[model samples]
Target: MRTLAPVALAAFACVAPCAANPALDALVAAYPDHLAGYESNDLIFRDGTRLPIDDGVKGKSFEQLLDAPDIKDQFAIPYPLGTANLRQPAFNEDPGRIRNQAMFVKMYGDCRKGEVKAQMKAVPWLPSRGGGTVMVTTANGVADQLAKVSRDLEQLPKEMTQYMVPSSGTFNCRVIAGTKRLSVHAYGAAIDLNAKFGDYWQWSKPKGGTLAWKNRIPLEIVEVFERHGFIWGGKWYHYDSFHFEYRPELIALARQGWPK
Candidate 1:
């Protein structure tokens, strides 16, 4: 019997640590063991590492934000919370797309240097469906949460299992294609679902400089991952329906009714 309900995500808002920047507060609370708190202009870690919250650069283009964004830039585009808020995003409105590479590196360690693999452990993936396993980081209870994701996924109708089993892959020590920035998979904290039913903006290649968002992954599967602190790429303007990554901060902020 499944004991965890998606509604339990509401607790992310109810008990987040209060601070000037709610994003930072959610970030600290999400990974309690890795983060301490934020100072006036820096995010302080439990290991005494202080990373600047802002890069002091203004008016950065979309590409600039993608390539070189500060920690706070992660919250520049607010992530819409649930199936209720799903919509066709405006141009370049990619919430959870702008990442702070340095920040992730600080906590998850660099995969190139083989620091991330040391924390990698296999999580059961759709056991009842013969999905086998995928490697994920043990950091911040990610492995545990993914295990929960697997359990919840199994509870869905058996036919839905076809879309989830045989994961695309996880824990890849590589950068996102055509970019120097490391993928969340490089940190062993992202999962790509079965590609047969997935859709990605990159594959669409729409005419002109426009993006046509497409998604075949069911919202039911997405909601299960969200309940366990994963954000779906289907929500992004540059949608990659197969991608789901750990980013509990955005989830918490959305529950707090932010990005207004």
Candidate 2:
């Protein structure tokens, strides 16, 4: 929610050719409904709003990156795709965590204003196991894509139901545990599985600035979600093993091996 100074805006505008940015290309490709394309250093939305790609802040602290980021910052850390290749990310290597709040609010609508629930669609989560319906947004066909994920998840062995059945939540109008920043759940595009089997960074405090990463969510389940464009929170340095959110742009960037 930080405003750009006029001088900063003029200086950073269009420093590189628009075509040279694969990140921007991936973003437009991921969500065609909200974004039209990129021009110079601005992201052109379908509504004709040209948002600045950079906020003119250099060497941002991790907190700054999460709370105040421009459109381009969303792609600053390339997401690692698939379980076979993902590593225990180095400190603060949270790829899809750095979201461009302005861009997201533009697409998903602000939940605080009652804008997000209006777009909700009830999706049957693992109907085969009698898992009840969950509400999610229809934006960018998220509900449809989740249906596809459900089809794949339900096919897994019945024992897996213990980990998946009774989804923790989907749409919640709230901020992240300690930050002013809104959670993806606020947009109704994120899902949390059975919390009983999930591990969150905040749930267990890190010691001496080092986080001992842990996970109970099976890699098989992670792969299923990744295949359909949802990024796993377990991949983060501050991991959340039971969280999955629809972030196709991050998934698209990972597929291209993320331009260095």
Candidate 3:
């Protein structure tokens, strides 16, 4: 998820309240190692920091939501799991965007300051496919979950191996393109599968028009990642088919039951 410019934050004068919901519950359950619980309007961290879930603003435009979002904004788009059949998301309906900066910085230290690297551990990808090891954050058992993902992918048919080999790269401490927000990769909690099979919105979008949803990655591969708590970027409206990031909260909620 990327951050919007500061100018975007200045537009909203108040934010709406954040009531307890399935999304919040999934968030609390997903990161038991860090989150304690959530209140009517604030999320209480294990360290007892009271973070405001909503910024008290309402009626934000799609661009505004992308530029400046509170915790609740992250759930504005309900992430659809187990399938890739859907229309293009309403503008800016990026389910995984709108990450709370404070919460993430607290859970996974700031990589720009070298805090994230200290906790990173390497996990071997598809060895048979010539995939070398990639480093992921050890915090919140992310490394362990990714290892499971690798093992599952190894069992796939040989033809699918093409998309499993030669990973793009991981654990780069860089901002997302054209945004001030830190990429999930910076936290060592994300991975990019084969770039050859990848399809990105920027690359697929028609001139002067909307983003066309296109994907070549198989559902079998997507399901494997979701089983281990990773969310595929292909699921996003602004799709990036090769990208997958650790976000078990969304998966757990979808599996157990999503609140209507």
The superposed Cα distance between candidate 3 and the true structure at residue 173, in angstroms, equals 0.5
The model with the greater TM-score, 2 or 3, is 2
Candidate 2 vs 3: which has more lDDT: 2
Provide the TM-score for each candidate, comma-separated.
Answer: 0.91, 0.92, 0.88
lDDT of 3 by residue, 1-260 (tens): 12233344233212134344777778877887777666668776666677888899999887777777888887777677787564566655677866767778889999989999999998999876788899999988999999999999999998998887888877999988888888889899999988999998878746557677878888899999999999888877788889999988888877875756
Q: Output the lDDT of residue 12, model 1.
A: 36
Badly placed stretches (over 4 Å) of model 3 are: 1-20, 84-91
lDDT of candidates 1 onward, in order: 0.86, 0.86, 0.80
Alpha-carbon RMSD, each predicted model: 6.8, 6.1, 8.2
Per candidate, the number of residue pairs that clash is 0, 0, 8
Error of 1 at 251 (Å): 0.5
lDDT (Cα, tens digit) per residue for candidate 1, span 1-260: 11223344323322223346677778878877777666667676666678888889999999999999999888889888789667888889888989999999988999999999999998999988999999999988889999999999999999898789889999999998889999999999999999999998878987688888888888999999999899999988889998999999899888889865
Ranking by TM-score: 2, 1, 3
Off by over 4 Å in 1: 1-19
The C-alpha stretches of model 2 lying farther than 4 A from their native spots are 1-17
